[model samples]
Target: MSSNTLSAVLEKLIHRLCLNDFPCGYGTWRKTKGSTEGAETEETDALLDLLSCPHSPWRQDGSWSPQTAALRQLAVLTPERLHTDFIYSYFTTLHILDKGVSVVDDGLLKFSKLEELVLSANKISEIPAENLPSTLKILELRDNWLSALNSLTSCPPPRLQYLGLSSNSLGSHDVVCHLTGTHWPQLVCLDLSDCEFQNQQALLDALSTLPCLRTLVLEGNPFTLAPSYPGLTVDSLPRLSYLDASRISPEERCSFSSLSKITDLIEDRASATVSVGRVRGIPDPSMSLDENAPDFPVITYGYFITYEFLSHQTVDLCCSQKVSESKCDAAHVTEDIFSDADLQSNKNLSKHRTSKLTWAECMDFSDTQTYIVSDLGGLKRFFNQGLYLTLEEEKVLSWPAASEDRKGGKEKESPIKSGSTKDKDKKKKSVPDLVQDAPIRRTLGSVHVPLQGLVKRGHKVDVLCDLGTLHTESELEATQSLEKDLGKKIKEDKKKEDKESKQRGGSGTKQKNTAAFKGRGKGNKESETDVHTDNSVSVQLEPLTVELSVELEKWQSAAEANQLTLPHKSKQPDLS
Candidate 1:
């Protein structure tokens, strides 16, 4: 039973349900809630279970009824229901025949009014669609044993939208040819996710023309085919608004700010080899990172390739000089050699394309760096072996390498000797001589050498590594031995400076101190002199007191005539 049939059946049942005509197929065995002869009851448990089953029914009786059906809208399976004649008479709108139901055939055409059909998770090996109804709109056929979709050609429902054909075992040309034929007119959402599509060209070409397609989800699909690289779905789905092709290794969430790995590319398959490609990130639309920010990121990049035979075109740094002749060999060069044809006329440029390495040219620098770092801890030794560094160890060995023996076991000495003659005109000033790489005496008791070298000759002898790092406390104290060498010089200089300062200063240094003390002493003497003068005056005042008293008595007599009391309490404060 399809959705149309189910809907019609439900509408009819809701309007008029005869309980006497249809009691559930439980056979009156389960305890009853009511005893009314024709009263309607809700079959919640039985009805829900029936929705997912085949076109059969458990009727209003004590047993199963494969012939008769009962429900609001859902019609369920009664153990075994196969052909159209069994379920056609009943009306159902949404039929779910999935998983174990591999028995459907032209019997599906019986539900002429179905709007939604689901037959997923089944073992349906083949579907002959000659009897497909036109009323069908939404169809779900996921997780099935389907290999071809070509059956939908003639009777393809014009109103079909939201088709979900995911998790199907589809792998054939017919499926491709059928889906590629015409646009699903009303189709807006198609979920063909996890279908493992092998024919990507046809799929992309067909889907690009879908006028109504807006939402396409194709996660976990291996999307690649002939002449095309994997992940074309990410590029071809132009109208898709959301994409989730995150990496498979780390289930961890993405850190979009670190997406600046684009700088590693100088050429890519999409930009260099193919005419079509998706932008790394859209500025106006957030198709990549920092969606809240109103700017699209620009990817920076460079490219590389593997070289089969690398030669040189200019002076190589490791070029050997003929000792007696004192001249460099022209065969050695500064860089890799180019093909004769490339040097003359760049034959590959005839196609009006700028010359660049394809996947076939030179080795990637990352791989080379990884190799050098693994063995030599950095690229320093790799470059030295290739372009510089004459090895003394090669000469010290009694048994030299076959190549060395064939050439002659003699080694080239460094151009410079320690603190030697300054006749620089006798030699060309290239990089520093290897002899300078010997241990440098930085402290008193022990010697050390620099781990790094001059980047250029004219560069200053600035500290590469901190001197403090190279010494222990004991080692630092050992360097105090320098004070012994400079003992006489430092003391003599100090004495001379002290003598000169004393001569220039004269006696004025003590004059300021002495003048301050002298002023204080004079002030004390002045106070002492005043005290002495006061004492002498007091002695003289003692005799004059008698004369003053007589005068004071006479004055008191005069004051008494003016009504003043003798100058006792009258002239004094009140002690009372």
Candidate 2:
């Protein structure tokens, strides 16, 4: 029989057994103090066995009620006792935690006026919304095995104001979306502390759309580890008053707003720069090093420098030749690159941003010198010295020709040499004369320091280091020997290939002579056949050679026409 029909029949049986004093006369089963064990009475045993009878809907492991082990003292409190209005109507709240209640018992369905339910610490995999009464306002289902939120969507509690679903398995993004739509309109507080959402952004985004959500508990979640979570959460959900149990301060909100605006502006600027198709970080070819340029110090330090200041700023350095080529009326190109409006904007934003140094005063660079340190001493020593260095200028030691340009020069060399046959006749070019590549610069061996120690205060000093030459005679001799050996090997290989080809050609000619003279003694027929073959080969090659010449002439004519049209187009533009 169904739970309802069996409940009805049991109710009648209980009423017949104790007609007037059924539930109130015998006091409710009391816990035995200091007694941990209790044997089941015959009546309770019979009732339990009947509940787990064959074909029962609630039977699991062939046991009478898997969830009622803690209720061993009151095993006789069957569905019949709970079905009465006198017993069920007396309670509006129920606490069934740690009871192993896998199923929402038929006994709980009788509580039509139930307002609060605590089913935490149980094996309840799911909650039947239809089984739960509509009067429930607060449902605490913490530490359960519920994997879905479909129960709430199916029979949504209209008056549910508080829900505690911490440490549950309800982590689906779809469930989060379903939650924000048309369910729990009166829900003002929600506790989903440890739901383990994999997509944190989706969860936060869905929560942003909840109109009545004020306080939210998301402690122990992976999203809490994000560095900007506080700012992002406050920015995303403006209505959220409390997040992770902390109140959102007004100052924090203002800071988040400013940060968001700055990020958006940076993104827009980057996008605009990209769309303009301007190449960045490439040094212009015209910017050659000025050998006569004077040395300039970029930093200074002394006892007079009581205060130190630091700033995080970006500097844009362009090629000097490019600056000159712009041909603007301004005295300097740097000023034009950094416009007045942009400088003012940077100055305004600088007030809001903090500097790294402890002191704020500026330094006086007059009567001070900064040393150029070698790369041998790394960052550790530099940081200990409290010195700063900025790369003011760089001089490229040598410029290498591009591969395409070098290949083109090589291809044109043959044609140029053919026309200049008289020069080759006079004297052949040497290997060094033919090679067109920049020589490697000599490395500095030893630097000469005039003074090593720190100078006295207010003393003008010029420290000069004389680096010794690194190109030794022995090294030069070794390089020349290596190059000579490589050239000799290349020539030998070429000569060997030519000798093998000549030998093969001689052998082939001998074999052909024998075949042509086979079964003949100085015969005229053989000579005639050879003459015919030679004529036939020449006749076949004549048309191909003529066609190639004609095509070459046509191409040359087209190129000449294009060259003539270019000046006419240029002259027309100039005249206009």
Candidate 3:
């Protein structure tokens, strides 16, 4: 590329990567004000701003204009600095996604201080180890056309902690064998998903050498179809904390302990049953009240379960028209709920709308839920491809006044007034009104289940999901208090600004006033107490967990058995 093209691309990339530090366009400094004095003042301010920016390396002593100096520094795109005065030493992170880079050229070595380099979704086919900086900790080359990793294996970055090579063509066992700890001693995470490796045992054995490899992704490989699967891989690499993006749960590790040795007995096809049980250990709101407060509102609680899982079954659009319509209606309700001017006034309405949407998605009314799996192979593939299975506890809280109103309404409608005693005794009881205000719903906690390991066992599997509440009442109170304090501080600053403006008595010139306004705006932007208002509340608290139980089992289907027993057709003699 030409120098101008390279400069523009680099400037745009830098601006995108450091958006917070350089909010304005890179060429903003080139614009001059109307008057000479104003232009000088603005230029001085711009130079100061550039110097103060966290990402900019331009010094105030530079002979060229601030913008020109920055662009010149970016223009010298060599592996090593062409001149001694270049500012490449300040670069720490470089992200060039989908940039059509066909090679890991020597130009990248200019960034001596670079730590995180992401060149994902590029046209690159090879990564020369010598072109990489020694200080790199994160190197991602995902979605590239790389087939061999000899360059990386021959000379790896010593401090490399993360290496993303997913969606490549490295399927050969010889190529995978280079992923040993000897090459990348400090590699913590390695992603090789969708590489099409076939040898399960060899892949696992190679990965087992990495001492600090806590996370590994081997999905989309043919070997994932092996009956042993994740259990074998898990047992082989005992130190792995995560496999294929799913956390290695303690239960899974315990169940799959030494499972690699018994791989021969594992079945290819099996039916499995999974059940989610009731939740417990929810804190009672009434327990926090004192005995003397008898008149305190009656606090009521309702519970439900919500979960998310990858469904292998494809949805038929023609059959799901009614479901789609209902979802659309729910979407409209959500928009209406959030559009209200006063959120507190329509809190109940919003809660109902949110509940309706949740129910349409994954909310379950029953305390217990069950699922059966007949094809272990299909389930294993879903799990291997980073399928997420989560169970959550949802709690609904009803205020005392609402509960009392409901009770009073029931009592007033219960008795008959205009009838004889016999008639009144024979009268049927009145039914309660169906239209009631919605209760406040909150998600207490959720847990991720390792389904791959569970199904691999091919028998009954019981799992206890530990749900932890992210926030407490005390934490909410503290957050509210902090927000109030920030509001007060903002009000006080505004008052001070108003007083100062009043003291000027409208005597200030337009330019000075404009400058003053810009200064105030910048100050407001930088203020730590500038509270950002959002629809949701934020709070922090210690983990308070509740437990729910789940059970799972697998069995072989009759169709699979029949297929295995069917004899192959014999060719007829002398048919030709």
For each of the candidates, the C-alpha root-mean-square deviation to the true structure, in angstroms, is 41.9, 28.2, 19.7
| C-alpha lDDT values of all predictions | 0.37, 0.42, 0.53
Cα lDDT tens digits, model 1, 415-437, are 33324466443443533322211
Model 3 lDDT tens row, 246-301: 89987777766766665444433222223333344444444334586433233444
lDDT ranking, best first: 3, 2, 1
The TM-score obtained by model 3 is 0.40
Higher-lDDT candidate among 1 and 3? Answer: 3
TM-score of 1: 0.31
- On TM-score, the stronger of 1 and 3 is 3
The residue-level lDDT of candidate 2 at 18 comes to: 35
**Which ranges of candidate 3 are over 4 A from the true structure?**
1-40, 43-86, 225-227, 266-576
Model 3 residue pairs with clashes? 79-110, 271-554, 271-555, 272-553, 272-554, 273-552, 273-553
